[model samples]
Target: KKVSEFIGKTTNNVAEYTALLRGLELSKEFNADEIEIKCDSKLMVNQLKKKWKVKSPNLKPLYQKVRLLLSAYRKVNLIHVPRSIIKAADKLVNKAINSSLDKDVEVHFVEEETESTLF
Candidate 1:
């Protein structure tokens, strides 16, 4: 797992995309065959799905980067989640404003051997 934080002075939509881009980079670093992206921002989710058009120039490039990253995944699942379930990405945005909250920014490598039977 790899995480990155981008901060300060940007529109909500742009910040959402920046977080998303970083997420994608992390996914790739993790060697994910498929990706499940969860975001609390409805506008960002809608924009990625073409349900909403991006009119701001600041968002256009980010949108394109997202599109490109998505293309690399064999299967991509983008989900609109409640803020309650999206603390990590939310923290990324806040980390930009204040660096102290950026603990989630990490590059982790975990190897899975097999399934476990806890029952």
Candidate 2:
């Protein structure tokens, strides 16, 4: 499953945390017992794993929230990976960013019976 949204102006770290939160929520919904989270952000990975202290005031709460989410799973692993290995997620982020910038694009859905009318 994939999820994306415009979360307004925020730092890259904040955006990454938002994605993590959504992913965690979805995993719980899918009844996943074990989850392995791979992230390109070193700071985020370290903070979530308690390897590094959360020094940023803005990220402290987010870090705590992630820790709480981790407790819900039976087993969870947080891994830090290089950006090259995370290309697919990168593309999703890029697509979301580009779509947000191009507000002029419009999409409409039509009923199957009226397909000819849409044309």
Candidate 3:
């Protein structure tokens, strides 16, 4: 499954963190024991992996939430990939943004498939 949510006027880091949090939630709901998380945001990935410090006060709570959710899984791999590798997600984000702007309402898109991959 793929999901996109329109959160208004937030910084890029906050958006990245929010996406991770949502992904973790979905994984938990599905009772997934192991998951691989891939994102184009290096800062978010590194922060989660403990390679870099989360210096922004705005991200502290988000970081903590992500960490808390992640503990339920038996194994989790956080990988940072180039943005080009995630064009489908980028398109969803653009769609969400456009829908929110045009309709003046919050946009949330969820596409389900027989085989699911969280994004």
Best by lDDT: 3
- Candidate 1, residue 91: Cα displacement in angstroms equals 4.4
* Per-residue accuracy of model 1 over 8-93 as CA lDDT, tens digit each: 66777777788778777767767766776656777887787787898989999999998898887777676666775556555545
Give the true-structure RMSD of model 1: 8.0
TM-score of 2: 0.78
Using TM-score, rank the candidates from best to worst. 3, 2, 1
lDDT of 2: 0.69
> Could you tell me how far off, in angstroms, the CA of residue 25 lies in candidate 2 after the best superposition?
1.0
TM-score for candidate 3, residues paired by index: 0.79
Clashing pairs in 1: 7-96
Q: For candidate 3, lDDT tens digit of each residue in 6-119?
A: 778778889889878887887777888888776778788778878799999999999999988988877886666677766666776677565554222243323321222322
Q: Under the 3 Å rule for N, CA and C atoms, how many clashes does model 2 have?
A: 0
Each candidate structure's TM-score, on Cα atoms with residue i matched to residue i, is: 0.72, 0.78, 0.79
**lDDT by residue for model 2 (3-48), tens:** 6677777899988988888778778877776777777888887677
